[model samples]
Target: MMKEIEFTLNGTRTRTETQPGERLLDLLRERLGLTGTKEGCGIGSCGACTVILDGKAVNACLVPAQAVDGRELVTIEGIMQNESLHPIQDALIRHHAIQCGFCTPGLVMSAKALLDENPDPSRGEIQRAIAGNLCRCTGYEQVIEAIQDAAKGGKTQC
Candidate 1:
C-alpha cells in the first residue's frame, strides 16, 4: 500500500506517496527526482547515499522512505543558494578533493553535518566525520583539507 508522508525537504514542506519498504534513496532519486544522493553500495556501507536528517548525516539507503515522514532532509541538491555552490562544495572544487564525482555528494553532506555541529572541528574530528565516506580519488588529504578550509567560513544558513 502507498501511504502519504509529509516532511520538510530542503526547507520546503512536501507531501508524497511512498511504500513502507521503499528506501529513502529511491524516494529521493526515483520518486522525488533528486538524484544527487547516489547509491554506491545500497547497503549503507558506502555512505554514498548520505544526507542530513534532522541535522545529522545519515545513510539514506538504510533509512526507510517513511522514516522521514516528519523529519527534515537535506540532500546535495538542497545545499546551493542562488546559483552559488555551498562552501563545502566550493572548497571541494578549489581543493581538488573531488575525483570521479561519485562520492562527492555524500562527502559534501557529511562535511556539512560536521561543520554544522562543530564549526571548527579538528583534523581528527574531520577524519572521523568522513570516515564512513570512501573516496579512492583524493586520498582524503584533500578532502580533509577542503573540510578545514570550509570550516573557516562555511558556517552559514547552509
Candidate 2:
C-alpha cells in the first residue's frame, strides 16, 4: 500500500507517497534525491544515515518513511543556505575533520542536533552526541574540536 506523507524537508514543505515499511533513507536518497544521508549500515548501529528529525539526530535507516509525516526533517543538504556551508560544516573543514567525507554528513547532523538543543555543551557531551557516528579517519580528536569550535564560535574555551 502506498501512503502519502507530508513533512518539512530542509525547511521546505514536501509531499510524497511512501511504501509501507519504506526506509527514510531510501525516500530521501531515491525519492527526493537527497544523497547526503549515507547508509553505512542497513541497521542503526552506524550513524552514517543520521538526520535531524524535529531537532534531534536520528538514524534515517531506522526511521520509517511514514513515520516522518507531519515532522520536520533536516538532511545534510538542508543545512546550508545561499550556497554557503553551515557553521558546523565550515568548522569541520577548517579543523580538517573531514577526510573521506563519507561520514561527515552524519557527524554534522549529530552535532547540529546537540547544539540546537544545548548551545553550550561540554566536551564530554559533544563526545556522547557523536558517539553513534563512526569515522574511520580523523580519530575523532579533530571532529570533537570542530564541534567545540562551532559551539563556541571559535572562541577560546576554558
Tens-place lDDT per residue, model 2, 1-158, is: 99999999989999999998789999999999989899998898879999999888999999999999999999999888688989888888888888899999999999999999999999999999999999997779999999999998855332
What residue runs in model 2 are displaced by over 4 Å at the alpha carbon?
Answer: 155-158
What lDDT does each candidate get?
Answer: 0.92, 0.92
- Per-residue error for 82 in candidate 2, Å, reads 3.5
- Per-residue lDDT tens digits of candidate 1, residues 1-158? 89999999999999999998899999999999999999999887878899999999999999999989999999999999798999889888888887799999999999999999999999999999999998877779988988998899744322
Deviation of model 2 at 101, angstroms = 0.8
What's the distance in Å from true for residue 157, model 2?
A: 14
Error of 1 at 147 (Å): 0.5
For model 2 the TM-score comes to 0.95
